[model samples]
Target: MKAILAFAPLFARLKGAMLLTLLLSLVTLAAGIGLLGLSGWFLTAAALSTLGSVFNIFAPSAGVRGLSFIRILARYGEKLSGHDMTLRLLSDLRAWLFARLFPLVPLARRFGRGDLVSRLLADVEALDTLFLVALGPISTAVLAGAAMTVVLALLLPGAAVIYAVLFFSAVLLVPVGLVLASRRAGAEVVAAGAALRQAVLDGIDGHQDLVLFGARDAAVASSDTAARRLSAARRRLGRNAALAGAMVQILAGGALVGALLVGFVALEAQQIDGPLLAGLLLAIIASFEASAMLVRSATRLAGAAAAADRLQAIATSAPGIAEPAAALPVPPGGEIRLEAVRFGYDPAHPVIDALSLAIRSGECVAITGPSGAGKSTIAQLLLRLVDPDAGVVRLNGADLRDVAGAELRRRIALMTQDAPVFLDTVRANLRIGRDGADDAALWQVLEAVQLADFVKALPGQLDAIVGEAGRTLSAGQARRICLARTLLSEADVIVFDEPTGGLDFEAESAFLVELPALTRGRTAIVITHAVVPASFDRVLELRAGRIAERAHVPA
Candidate 1:
């Protein structure tokens, strides 16, 4: 409940629409009940007036017609307002969840790609039931029940008390009990659904690896087990909800019986006429129709609560990088310096210890080291993806922590070996680096990365679709496309983590030869295990998280 309440601000914005929905729902329920009660009373009165020959029929007949008309119109209005409010709420919720989750990409990925997808698409969607099923139905029941109770009290106080007691028991007590009974099963259903989705995704994504490793059977079995668990949990929750609905029906039936028994006594004592007695009995049955919604509402509330808890966990998790309270401006020059930086994935195994280095403005420097020598960590630190544990990283004497991350990233662009290639048009992918970049600017960057010819040969050229992760293109082509994207950025400093990793020796050498011209004005830092090219001004070797050797590369 607390997790769901976290979105109170979002709900507050839709309160007006929600209130209108509730009003229409109430009016719809009231009119429907009035129609039934009036019809029953009018029939009885007409029969009696035919025998007495002195009773008026015009007023009752007009009321029956008017209520029938209102019932249809109010029902239509209720559906319109309710659906409109729900759709708008769902749209806002998706956008809000995406905005909150986007910045926590590193942390989110730790939860597995399939798990994160389930949270984003499935878990977030489950919240729609929160309003449509739980809040709307439950609120309408309470308001309509109160109105019915007040109207009945005017005719017969005893019956009104009995109806109110039975109404609240079915609406509040029965639903509360059902929620408690199904809470654990509801949570299990949510977890099992997420697990099943993750298993399917894993099987699809890693089918090749599973086949190669002879683990395809194991993967299928795992997915089947998850599906079974999900089915079992859902069955249990359904059983509990069915039992609750049965109990609500019994309570509603009891209320109607009590109203009818009381109406008979009032008729015999002349406290109420036959027509009015018939109206009270019929209205009792009609009023309970709205209360019936609570039974279903209670069942769905448990699932919605579980979904809220899951979404809140990710939405509120602490970020890997903290934003500055008062951001400093980015420096004019891209002179990166690290002073005694220390970092580790865990305290027992440090990755970067007392690492100190500097790259002057507009100088191309290359850092070469064996695997796991903290070369890429330096790039991450420069880009402010993760802050150092103990020391300060500064850009032109301004501490990176003091500057806003977006501003810092704007000045320093990173192109990693496994840079993502989104399934979008070539133009769309490149424009990610510089939104609204002209075609000429895009072509220039593609030429610099040596991918212009390949793109031009494609059917759509600049508009060519790069399949998911650039699967449609060859490895070398995809890497170059990513490189072109990085080059399209207006950053003053560019860092490449193994820029030529995917290319053959000839292509690598060619790219290395063009590096100087590509990075002629901007400061460049290339982190790689490959041999350093003469295009760089200096080469530094890292060993055991410290700089072991430094050499000046001659022109």
Candidate 2:
């Protein structure tokens, strides 16, 4: 419940729309009760009236029609306002979650891809019904029940206490009991749903592997198990809700019976007429309409509560890195230095231990090493994705931690080994390097990467929408496209982690040969296992978590 309450601030932001929804719901429920009560009273009175008596049928009929119209209009408005607010809230939740999530990048280490996707889509969706079920219906039920009790109190005091007790018990006690009983099941349902989604995502992502390994049946079985778990959990939650609803019905019946008993005694004492008694009894039954709605929503409330807890966990988790409180400006020169830096998954087994290195501005340096030699860790350090446990990483003598991350990133662009080409136009993908870049610049970078001909031959040229992850493009083409994007960035420093990762031997040689001329004026650092060409200014080989050798080459 506390986790659910964590979203109170977001709810407050849309208070106006939510308030309107609640008001319309109250009006709708009230009008419904009044219509039922009046119809009963009007029919009975007309039946008991004399044949020639001045019975106002038109007045009662008009009142009934008016109440019906109000109910229809208010119900429509309630649904309209409620759904509008719901969509807006969902938008806000997604935006807020993304904003929180971006700062915590390298999320792969802590959260699985499928699990994060589930949180972003499924978990957020689970919270959309929070207000409609958890707040509005309960409020409507209480107010409607109170109004009916007051009417009973005035006309037949004997039944007032009976109605109030039974009504409150039905609305309040039953829902509370349902929530408590369904709490565990609701959490299970959410967990099972997330698991099912994860299973499906995993199967899709690994479908080719499954087919190649002849494990398709295993994957199908896994997905089936997840689906069955989700279904079973939902059944448990539904069962609890069904039982609670039955209890509410029993309470409603008891309230009606108690009212009848009191109404008879009051009629015997000449305190109430038969028609009036029928009207009050009918209104009492109608008032429980809100309670029925509340019971139905009570089950959803438990599910929503569980979802809120999951969302709150993500929202409240501390980011891996924190921005400096007072940021320093990046210096003009693109000199990068790592001094006695130490970092690793396990602190004792440092991947980069006491490793110190420095690169002057406008120099192109290539760092080469065997697999698991911590080549990529250096790239992460340069980008400040992870802070070192023991030393300082500086940009032009200013500590990387002293500058705003965004400012630092703008000055230093990195092309990671696994950089993805998103599902967008070729032009759109390149523009991410430098927004608003002209066509000539795009073509120049493409030409430098030897990809101009490939892109120009396409029907839409730069505007051609590529498939997701550049599936439409070959592996070498995708790698070059990413490399061109990095070359397009107007940064003082550009780091390429395996820039020619998927290229053939001939293409890789061509790219390496042109790397010097392409990044001639920037501080370029290339982390690769490829053969270092003579054109590079310097080369360093890493071994045993330290730079073991360095060689300088003349222009």
Candidate 3:
């Protein structure tokens, strides 16, 4: 499950016009150069043989222009087709990357800020080189080099032999060496860039905490270090690139000098005609420039691969829980049972272990424990966010894993203390629990949560645009709105984790008083550190990682 490159099959599946466009473009590029070389050879030969001849003058004039037109058409086709394919493929790559990422968020959020930031922005961007540019050029470079090698050998076997070696040196040898020299440096550079990206995310998210603690200056200093690290890595990698380029240039210059030396001797000895020597020499020079482009493309490959590796890592990580292929149908009752369950976010540190509990339909239970003593873990178990490492979680005797995902989640409504308020309208946030709810339906839930009056008094009422993370609302109001969202679900089972955490005495009182009505006929599990009034219900406490005790309400 940890092998990240498992998703390569998805990329290898792009079909239809995408592959065709890439092929057509590369063919056009190689063919255009070949035609241009032929035109030059023909024009030279005609003039040399027919000096002051009538047919020679007209043929060069008419035939050269016709060849020029054909070349321009191929060049145009190559550029357009290559560009079209790259753009479309870029879109497909981004979507696939995003889908791979979404399933990992709950697990990945456990990573440090630097790692997450880099994965989202820096790593994703690094892949631009692979999809948008290199794919086509790398293909064309190999194909064109092969065609040129054959033509040179046919023209003059000795000269072509020399050119073929140079082509291999430029296309393969030089680039491979450069990549080896720079590969580790390139990966380091990407890591540093991700660190810097994480620093930016932290600075923004912790802005209020930094201000309160008078640590703004310290935070900025940390960010500066991250930025410097990124810049230094880039500079070091750039040096490696410059060094590789220098080596390629030296090889290319020497090959061209060799061609000139060999070419002049052949002409002087009258082994090949002047026209044929000129044509072969020009072809060799053209191959050198193309190879230089190929080298630049190779250097970018290290950066691209570094990005792809991160994306692959996300695609292949294991999920916290795996659903079963089949299960017995769920019973009509919303009753749930946990038997000898043990679990942990980290194996070395168990959060809930050997915990056993049961809740009949229409029962309301309040779970209480010291902070970090697995109070929230019980609530999480009911929602099936994380399955117990050992033991069973069942709904009316049907194993949770066997039930369909949507069916399991739909009948249960949960509100966590750390739940983020989305950037949406007041109504929109409430509507998430019941998407097609009308105004009357929304008001009913608001009344149950004791927020009906406040919502009605708002200038925009249901249409009020809440700020990002519900910033425009006070803490208690935000919490109540979230509670209202839970109420609107009308689910068979409801689990509330510290729902009244931010509310004042007045708001808290109303919430506690009005909430029991909503839980009637539905199984409810409430997790809290605070004690509620002695109501007619069961109470459970957790210690270490297990359920410590269960008792009836003392009153």
lDDT scores for all predictions? Answer: 0.84, 0.88, 0.72
In terms of lDDT, which candidate is strongest?
A: 2
Using lDDT, rank the candidates from best to worst.
2, 1, 3
Candidate 3 structure quality by residue, lDDT tens digits, 16-87 = 544665566555555456455556676678767755554456665565566566657756765675566556
Between the candidate structures 1 and 3, which one is better when assessed by lDDT? 1
For residue 418, give model 1's deviation from the true position in Å: 5.5
Residue-wise lDDT of candidate 2 within 61-165, one digit each (tens)?
Answer: 999999999999999999999999999999988988889898888798767776787788877887777887668899889988888888888998889898999
Where in model 1 is the C-alpha error above 4 Å? 42-69, 108-110, 324-330, 337-342, 351-360, 364-375, 390-392, 397-399, 417-431, 435-485, 497-516, 526-555
* Model 2 misplaced regions, further than 4 Å: 46-54, 207-232, 324-330, 368-371, 390-392, 417-431, 434-485, 500-515, 529-535, 538-555
Q: What is the lDDT of candidate 2?
A: 0.88
Q: Estimate each model's TM-score.
A: 0.82, 0.85, 0.73
Model 3's lDDT to the true fold? 0.72
Pick out the ten consecutive residues of candidate 2 with the lowest summed lDDT. 546-555
